[model samples]
Target: MAHNEKLALLIVLPSLLAGCTSAQMNMLTGKRNKTYNDVNAPWVGSTEEQLISKWGPPKKSYTLESGAKIISYEDMWGPISAYHVCVEKFMIEKGIVTKWGISNCPTRIKGSLPKDTPIPQPTL
Candidate 1:
């Protein structure tokens, strides 16, 4: 093979490998896109300072009995496909997410739930 061809292959091979590794890293890290609005991105690594820099102040703030700081924020899920959305709660302890829970807001439908719609009873 020509010397030029060998050098070209060497460069292209490393570039291709690097691209594949980066793609895999992005997928594993859940960085589907670069945006402050991606709800799927992991929130545990955030510090109070970094969170404020990115998303500003929380809508509400509270402290748990264990002395953990809980900052509440409003996150919209979908205006696109499914058109269903809800606000989620993130539990941050010592600047790390310990747990998360979702609110049971009504799902958007063609029309609002009927006035006569019975509330489902909770089951054990």
Candidate 2:
């Protein structure tokens, strides 16, 4: 790599890790909020049953001809005006989780959304 590129990376990497992430920090837990990567990394070699036990039932589960199964978990919370959705998929081979990924999850970076919208929060 060029000297300029290395300097640029050195300057940019810290800022990105400091706050550019979409993940929030949990007040109660004092831990970084769970992102798909953070939550699923440990489950890479875990069994399907073990995953299910921790995460409860998946939203959907199906198998491919290759004998690898995929388990998906989706969660959307908050009101219609401001909600978040993420569908996390895990690949299970021989009943053990081998790989996992998010098919289509949309997230607003911090400060991307307006704090004070003209529309008020609706009460049910």
Among all candidates shown, the one with the greatest TM-score? 2
Show model 2 residue runs off by greater than 4 Å.
Answer: 1-34, 103-124
Cα error, residue 11 of model 1, in Å, equals: 41
State model 1's lDDT: 0.54
lDDT of 1 by residue, 20-114 (tens): 64336556555332322224135556666766677778787888799877666665566576554454455677876655444543332222223
Can you give the lDDT of residue 116 in candidate 1?
Answer: 40
Write candidate 2's Cα lDDT for 1-124 as tens digits.
Answer: 9999999999998786677434342332243333345455668889999999999999999989999998889978667898767778888999999887763454232232222322221110
Off by over 4 Å in 1: 1-41, 75-85, 104-124
RMSD of 2: 15.1
Deviation in angstroms for 69 in model 1?
2.2
Q: Estimate each model's TM-score.
A: 0.39, 0.55
Per-residue lDDT value at 80 in model 1: 73
